[model samples]
Target chain A: MSGNENREKYKLNVGKIYEGFVIDHIHAGRGMKLYKDLGLEKLDCSVAIITNASSKKMGKKDIIKVECPIDRFDLETIGFMDHTATVDVIKDGEIINKPKLSLPKTVKNIIKCKNPRCITSIEQGLDHIFVLTDPEKEVYRCKYCETKYGEQ
Target chain B: MRHLLTPLDLSVEELETLMDNAEKIKADPEKYAHVCDGKIIATLFYEPSTRTRLSFEAAMLRLGGKTMGFATADSSSAAKGESVADTIRIISCFADIAAMRHPKEGSATVAAKHSRIPVINAGDGGHQHPTQTLTDMMTIRALKGHFDGMTIGLCGDLKFGRTVHSLIRALLRYKDVRFILISPDELKLPDYMTDEIKRNGAEYEEITKLEDAMPRLDILYMTRVQRERFFNEEDYVRLKDYYILDMPKMELAKEDMIVLHPLPRVNEIAVEVDEDPRAKYFEQVQYGMYIRMALICMLLDISL
Candidate 1:
């Protein structure tokens, strides 16, 4: 009964499916909550208890296992989702992987610009491509939008 | 010469050649006028631009070249559903080289692919206007003799400034230059370019107050801020009018500093400063045509 609360035996799989991006995770005391967030697809119960073995190291009698399926995802270059935009990763009626998304170089149009008056978005036939100039700074800007990421 | 596609297509040496010759031509316009005699420059504006299109035409005509092409897209094959590539192909047959203005970002890139003659991108869909970059080079050269070791202040709409973006890209090719970027929080320089600043190891400082940066700048480039861009009008109304440069700001700027705007300015700089010798924007505007003339002549494969 006491082992149910101790956290251990955690692992994350960033299947080669989402190639260009990392479906990352940081585990420790927070490992279980993060694991449950990316829970197994098709599981009916919000809380599923996995079989735990008693471990003296964990100071618990049992360890719960959290499993998730990256079912059928193919690593594509373009990004397709974000937080609060909860969407199920589906392919051929089967559940796949879910990940946060950001656009790569392949986008063909400008959805937004930093300059409201600039002609790119107001006009047609213009595609906005953003190059990741600084990865550490977390900056993304329109090739044409000129509206920089976190520009201030 | 011929068709300015993306700035990435040309080597730094090639851009320098254009700037060098443009300076020589600027010194003696009559010396290079006959080089393109009988050549016809077709504006082919698939959009409305009196400044750039006319400058292209004037550049050709000033160099003893002829001029023709639609000033508006509604009057051209574009209205007939003609593709940009086909129009450029057909135009190349009549003109020795073409200075084109299209509203599409990479439209000139597509035109450059098909045309037999060289293509000059007068302006593209807010993507790039390499000629404006040429004008900036011409301005820098005419003022500073070389692009190196100058401190330039770029203010207003840096976030989406096509001219600012092109000039920054071009300036990165040189050495020992620094930048002071001034604009409102909403109109800050785009991160893509700032990312470039970081990668190139260029020194740059971003600030909200133009007055704060004015004293240290050697060159000042200004762009218009339209009220319509703001998602909220109240913010625009509060900030737009006060952003203009007046007598007070000029005193804070260096005596050697030159003021430049990409034209069609709607009161960004005060009219009082126009009479000052350093108000080089009008001269910059005129120099724009001359550099363009130089560009047209070279791209057309004409010599001397």
Candidate 2:
């Protein structure tokens, strides 16, 4: 087989959006999770997902192209999921704003408290609130139980 | 504005104020007995801890305050799926302050967010037990005469001993407080805790042998190796008797060195050791009540 043919066979069928967002540089294997978490499947907009895309910066990455403008809150939420991700706002097939992702200082109801004895567990209607205690380590702890996120 | 959820919730000055108040309350019990008169303290224990609940109740009673709340989850509305927010909301109407103990790690924090009154966390799973930590501080200050430059040996169950975690965190604010962490490998202090020690620039040594660290310690903080914390019966049986404070171990420690333990001990501290001058665990119980009394007064904003 020709080298060109071999390249074409393995290439992802990711198409660009005329308007909306192109979430780039997602950690490899985490694109699908971000897709579901972002609720792109439920939105009545065109979305393309390219998994295991080769990148010079990141050895392997995933990209999501959406046909609708992403909200600021949604962008920050995406940052929480993968701090390394980059969100590029596109208008008329031209890249506009590319906000750098960072860990939010405080997040509400995003990650559930895992400590079984955490007040969030027994108390109904309580927001599973967490605060970023260690920004360098990207550690979030439950506001109530003080249990570090991912430890539970 | 007062909430005793974690040891950090109280500043060094506030902690000193509490210690001073506790000492004054101890000196003249009758003069301050009625300082909290007509005030109500809600003891919302969502977990069964007889010692902590009683200590809180006794503190309130000694302060001429009335105590009302359930002792267990089954007795409380928690069994009926009532939320901590809801419970605290309802209890705020009846009580001036609330002291809660829950099996869940951050239940009191949830309560504090929703409740209008002050909230004290009696014990919250393996996460925090700040009152016990306060009691420990008061004991250390009384026996050692200061919070500085003490070699505190914490022996047994460092992994699940919430008191050890809280005490260590609280003592870090003091000058030159070092720790001798003595526990078996399986029950060694959690990395998150040790990380805090390293971050605070405090010195600590992790070892398995209690006897080796005894001679160097100024205060021996013994803890019961609780069987309930273990998932496997065989592991519990193996580690339960790892360190027993007896006469020989006491001989190695300084003559003036004190021992502190959150009681209801299950053989980790030998019964014979109670007669020794250094055995301040029983006195710790009294300090727990006194410190709690001072805490209640402080939280309620009563001048005692």
Worst 10 residues of 2 chain A by lDDT: A68-77
**Candidate DockQ scores, in order:** 0.09, 0.79
lDDT of 2 at A149: 90
Error of 1 at B266 (Å): 1.7
DockQ, candidate 2, comes to: 0.79
Angstrom error of the Cα, residue B56, model 1: value is 0.9
Task: Give the best candidate by lDDT.
Answer: 2
DockQ of 1: 0.09
What is the C-alpha local distance difference test score of candidate 2? Answer: 0.89
Model 2, A100-150: lDDT tens digits are: 888988888777888765667766687888898888888888887677899
For model 1, how does the per-residue alpha-carbon lDDT over A58-93 read when each residue is reduced to its tens digit? Answer: 432222232333342322222311211222453444
Query: lDDT at A70 for candidate 2?
Result: 46
Q: Per model, how many backbone clashes are there?
A: 13, 3
How does candidate 1 fare on TM-score?
A: 0.69
Tell me, what's the RMSD of every candidate?
Answer: 8.4, 2.2
